[model samples]
Target: MRIPNLWVNVFIIFVLPNLSNGQQLSTKPLKLTDGQNGVKSIPYRATDQCMPKMDAKRGKTTYGLSFRLHSKGGHCDDGLLICYPGMLNRHADSLGFKVKGLFQIDNKKDNKVNQFCSFKMQKEGISAGQTHWRGIKVYTMPNGTENRQTMLEASVASRPYKLGTNVGQFSIHLGGNGTDLLTMITVNDGKAFIDNQANLQKQFLEQFWNGAFLREHTGLWMLGLDLLPSMKQENVKLFIARNCNCTMETWFTQPTDSSDPKEPELPTAGSNNCSIEFESTSEATTNKNDVSDECFGEKHFEIRFKNIFKKCWMKFANACPNQTELIMLTMSRRNGFENRMGIRQTWMNDSVPGEVIRFLIADAEDGEANDVQQKLEEEQAKHGDLVFLHGFVDIYAHLHLKVYGGFKWQQSFCANANWVLKVDDDALVHLRRLAYWTGKKFRPIVAQNPLVFFGKLYHKYLPIRNPKSKWYASKEMYPKDMYPDFMQGTVYLTTPATINAILLHSGQIDAFYLEDVVYTGILAELANVTLSDQKKHFKWRFDHFDEKNGECEDGVPTPFSIWGAEKLNVFEHQYGRMKSIECKK
Candidate 1:
């Protein structure tokens, strides 16, 4: 059965003098608003610095090309290459810098005359995560005569390289992604160059984002190479993503000078000259390590800042039959009657006595052709599990309200429940396994005031600036490049105290449409909520793209306590497998 939602937001603005451990909370009430952050979203205004990239119109189209490097006895004898791979600027601004996607310069005195050659190959239009090989070109000075000449160039790999002396050529990459231009490789001879300094890496990265090197509001990538002179050769790589905020990691052979060959320090992922609230994550003490980071590839270590939250959720559980130990608040649409019925007959029915499940729906999301509200009332009369919320339109953008409202609802009424689970109506929750894990894992921690916030963590992520994206965030809304680590909002678990912390903190910051990012990430950081980081224990119940691809073979029962956001038929099938004694976990 479900609880009704004719409830008002309760705010205890007074200071708590009798707080546990003599601790006091002086906090305000959560007042969520859609901060009129979209005045110029039509023609967005950017108040922050932007990155520079290749200016197509500002830079002339060269008529020629060349690539010549001198290698002797398996060692590079000459070549000096400096390639700044940047975005292909479509803007006609005078501040833009002209760069050929491919170029080569002969700095070698052995080449007689100091020759500078530059040209364009193909228009830069590659996408992120794709590596391509194209025939590149550049116009060179030829001999000492500065007339004009064209010479074609070559690339060892997709990466741009420079050997030594005046014997080298420059190579650049162009990408379809705004923030990502190309994957550039710079090979240094291990000298006293500015690029070798760790701080320079940060500066170049800064120039890449701020308008210092490009036009305002632009976000692009910059690559700097600082190699140790001692190492014969090393291969370092970085993969850029859509938001240009992927975790940077690599494995390389030690440079020759082992003493000072430290990993090059990079600017915090997605961070630039500007500051946002809690822009960088302070590390949190978790009992588990990140099992999810494997997706980023091999890394010796990852930088984690300190984020220590005060442990709060305490022992308040007794095995009383009527005592509701867990509250599963499923966010549902007002007209999602079919989904509700599907869940009721599936995982929702797999509940034990101490668990309570309710579907939360916004009042505004109801019927045109059908009387959704009346049918919901009838459904409530039959099931008694629907909680209707007021005061917000149920559009996709305002979905974050579902989180904030649902959490507010949880804290106000179900504070006594040992744990609170938030799930989507499309999600799958293995109540039986959750019940087992509660006793085996979660209960003990809850007994001692668990510092638990469980869900899959999206570690190094950047907010998208492209207006075409549904998740687009403007500078007025979220000016920061990186969002604090947030969970995939499909499902998450927390205790009453954590919810209180989040709610209070939510009152302190401006709200955004992306609820998981604002509440789960932004508020979660301020609340100091550390993730459970048990990724293998929680996952996505992947469905095949084609249902026709599915066979009538024996179904596999999922062992996870939660794996979610599934379709109706898949939910019913999985639920059947969960009940069948013949299925293996």
Candidate 2:
């Protein structure tokens, strides 16, 4: 089912409660000018004092109050905790919050998130004294007001939080049965953990205030995490709010905001400047599974690459095991730091594809710039070989491609290839099978519905979540009911000539964030190339299907792509066992 996009907000409140030894004293609430000397504070012993109607109805053993700061001006230019009648809590040493899941928040929207602050409180009981409020310090704001936002009705339950070692340990894993969002974090003085509802409302509210918004709104976005154990904290204090001007264009309609009513609608299908077809070797290579294109150039460039590589390899005095080479290139210097290390080690190892050649154009010769150069140079010397270009020469869209422009760097290296496969560093390649499969054919392996697996299928998004996700391409951005079958840029294959054509044609195409989707899917759409899916390219849940015919969960593993390394290792062990038995024959 095709899911529609929607919007939501998030907030993160970390509270530290110290009610150990004995009951503590309640600190005097800071006076506000709303016609009150001191604010009426709710003690920790009170049950259901703060009602935050959470999407998830789960919590802990004990309960307490914590108050999240609502910046008076809608934006938190000044760090202050203006108290209202919510739960009271304190911010731990590591005062940073992180959000991760199927939902993504754009950190670029608003920068005021860096200035907001909050407080921590412990639960009150019959035996628990007012002294319990001692460790709970009340931090006053320098320049902020209290009545900015309202507290929502939510769930009630308390659990111990680990504020020291496990304070910053935060992770959110999405995808599960029904619509439940689950979270697990370390708590209880490092002795145990708690699985409860992670204030997703608060998460979205923070994102909303910071200018980050959600995209899909059909299903509910769930969060599961273990609380940091230290004080008695409740789930009801969680809430989300946004002060930025809301816009449909900012959420899902447009890439950038504009008042032009004549603005073009999002393209559902068609090719653009960023799309191209690589050399396919033969008409059959391009015709596999009904994938066809006129702009791709009917002339297959496979033989030309084989002919060129035959000479280059011979000249270099190096020979690939079966004349199959995996040519990899990196364009941006920033990507070299963000993901290159993991990419090279996980996907470029010898057991996967034959060889992975990394090409970089060093912009500077010294300083930290040189350090990046030095690090990459050292990595190449240690892991494999590096190709360094002297200065600024734009072979591809260096500025726009960011992390996805690596394939554009393979132009000169196209000579040594039976097939050329382009993939991003973040993708975990299944090298062995990919190499073996590419050796058997020259046609591209595309998906029937690209990004669908990550969208409505395996990892689906709900409508109430943040609407500012990158995946929410509207009709103005895409025109078709669904994406044409195209190779995921994370991993796509072509003939050597096709690679060269793509390299040359890449100039006509403007660079995009996810280059693979832009080129193989969007660009191919315009070029009239029919994208076909190689069923084994993606993974389905084991229980979601009835049988496992040695399909390796998703499909065959390519040494160049990312697969579950542990699972792959287990398979390799089993393969070794089977191979030994076959050798006995």
Best-fitting candidate, scored by lDDT: 1
Off by over 4 Å in 1: 1-322, 365-367, 446-449, 543-558, 561-568, 577-585
Error of 1 at 531 (Å): 1.2
Candidate 2, 69-134: lDDT as tens digits: 221122111111222211211222222333333243222122222111111111011121221111
Error of 2 at 104 (Å): 42
lDDT for model 2, please: 0.29
What does candidate 1's lDDT look like per residue over 233-333, in tens digits? Answer: 11112111100111111112111111212223431221121112221112222312332221111111111112111111111111123477888888888
lDDT of each: 0.41, 0.29
